[model samples]
Target: MRLPCIGILTISDRASQGHYEDKGGPAVETSLRAILAMPFEALRRCVPDERPVIEAALSSLCDNDGCCLVVTTGGTGPAPRDVTPEATEAVCDRMLPGFGELMRMESLKQVPTAILSRQTAGLRGRSLIVNLPGKPSAIDLCLKAVFPAIPYCLDLIGAARLETDPAICPAFRPGK
Candidate 1:
C-alpha cells in the first residue's frame, strides 16, 4: 500500500529566503512522528508570509498532492504578517474552531500569553489543515492538546486512516 501523505508547511519570510533555519516544519514532523504509528510521507514546504503564496501552497497540498492532513506553522500571530489563518480559512470549506480553542485553553496553562495565539484548524477537500504557532516548543504542546481528535476528524473527512500509539496519542474513535 502507498504511504499516506501529510503536509508540513512552514510560513516565514526568513526561513523561506534561507536567512534563518526553519525549525517549525521539523518540529511539526517530529510531533506527528511521535503520535502516529501508521506510515506516511511528510510533504513539506516553506513559504514566505505572503497570503497568496500560503494559499497556493495549501491548495496544492490538498487538491493536487493528495495530502490527508496539512499542518502549518507560524504566521498565526497578531502581527500584520500573520496571515496563515486567513489563508487557511480562504482555502477551507469548513472551519473547526474547537481545535484552536482547545489548543489555546491548554497552552494558557503553560504561558499567560496563550491568549495571543490565533491557531486554528479547517478542512480543504479531504485534507485537514491545522495552524500552529511558530515556536518549536509550542508546536508540540498544541499538537499534543489537539491530536487526539485528529484521527477521528480524518475519518469523518474521508482522508487516509491514521492510527496512533496509545502511549503517545491514543486517537479517539467512536465505539473503539
Candidate 2:
C-alpha cells in the first residue's frame, strides 16, 4: 500500500517568530500517530497568523507537496489575526461545514466558549484541509470528533486510502 501524506500547519505569530514553542502542531502529530495505523508521512510547517501566508502554505502543501490531508492549528478563533478559515476557503473548491459544526458541538460539551471557535474544513483539489483550534486540549477534542470521517472524505476525493485499527478507533463506512 502507498503511504499517505499528511500536512501539519501551525499558525501562530509567537510560535513562528520563535518567541514561544508550538504545542498545537505537536499535539496534532501525536493524535495522528495514535489513531492512524496506515503508513503515512507528515510535512510540518510553522507560519504566522497571516492570511496570505496561510493560503500560500496551504497551496504549496496541496498543489506542490501533494499532501492528501492538511490539518492546520490556530487562527480559528474570533480574534483579528484568526484568518485560517478564510485562507482555507480561498484555496478550496468546496467547504465541508459539518466537520466544524461537529467539532464545535463536541467541544461545547466540554467548554461553553467553543461557540467562538471558527474551525472549518474544506477541499483543495484532492486534499482535505481542516482548521483546528490552537489549544492542545481543544485540538484533541476537536480531532477526535471529526477524524472518523476524514479517511472516508479523503477516499471520496481520490486522495488516498486509509485503514484504521478497529480496536483503537473504528472508522465507519456505509457498507462496512
Candidate 3:
C-alpha cells in the first residue's frame, strides 16, 4: 500500500523571494499532522504570485509527483496579484464551489473580511486542489470547515485513500 502524498504549495511573492517567512505552508502541514490518521508525505513548494508558475506547479504535483491532493496557500484575496483561484480553475476539470462557500461561511464567523476571500477547490484529474487564504489562522479555520468532506471527495475522484483521526477531524464518507 502506498502512503498518500499531499502537495503543500505556498504562493507569495515576498516569501518566494525570501523577504518574508512562509507561515501559511507550515500551518497547513501542522493541520495535516493533526488530522491525518495514517502516514503521508508532504511535497512542499514555494513560488511567486505568478499564475503560470502556479499552474505549472499544480500540474507537476498532480501529474508527476503523484500527489492525490494539492492545497495552496495565498493568492485567494481580492488583491491585484491574487490569482491562485484562476490558475486552479484553468487546470481543473471540475469546480467544487461548495468548498469555497463553506470556507467563507465559516470564516465569516471569525472575521468580516472572510467575504473578501475568494478561496475555492477543484478536481484536477485524480487530484483535488484547494485554494486557502493567506493568513495562517484562516488556513486552519478553512481547513477545519472543509476537510471533513475531503476524503469522500478524493474517493469520488478516484484519488488516494485518506483517513483522518476521529478525534481531530472525523471524515464523513457516507454510510461508513
* Candidates' RMSD to native: 0.6, 1.0, 0.7
Off by over 4 Å in 2: none
For residue 137, model 1's alpha carbon misses the true position, in angstroms, by: 0.6
Candidate 3 residue-pair clash tally: 0
**lDDT, residue 116, candidate 1:** 93
Q: What is the lDDT of candidate 2?
A: 0.92
Sorted by TM-score (best first), the order is 1, 3, 2
Model 2 error, position 112 (Å): 0.6
Residue lDDT tens for model 3, 129-151? 99999898999989988999999
Q: What tens digits encode model 1's per-residue C-alpha lDDT throughout 11-99? A: 99999999999999999999999999978999999999999999999999999999999999999989999999999999999999999
lDDT tens readout by residue for model 2, 42-156: 9999999999999999999999999999999999999998999999999999999999999999999999999999999999999999999999999988888888898889888
Q: Could you tell me the TM-score of candidate 3?
A: 0.98
Model 1 local distance difference test score:
0.95
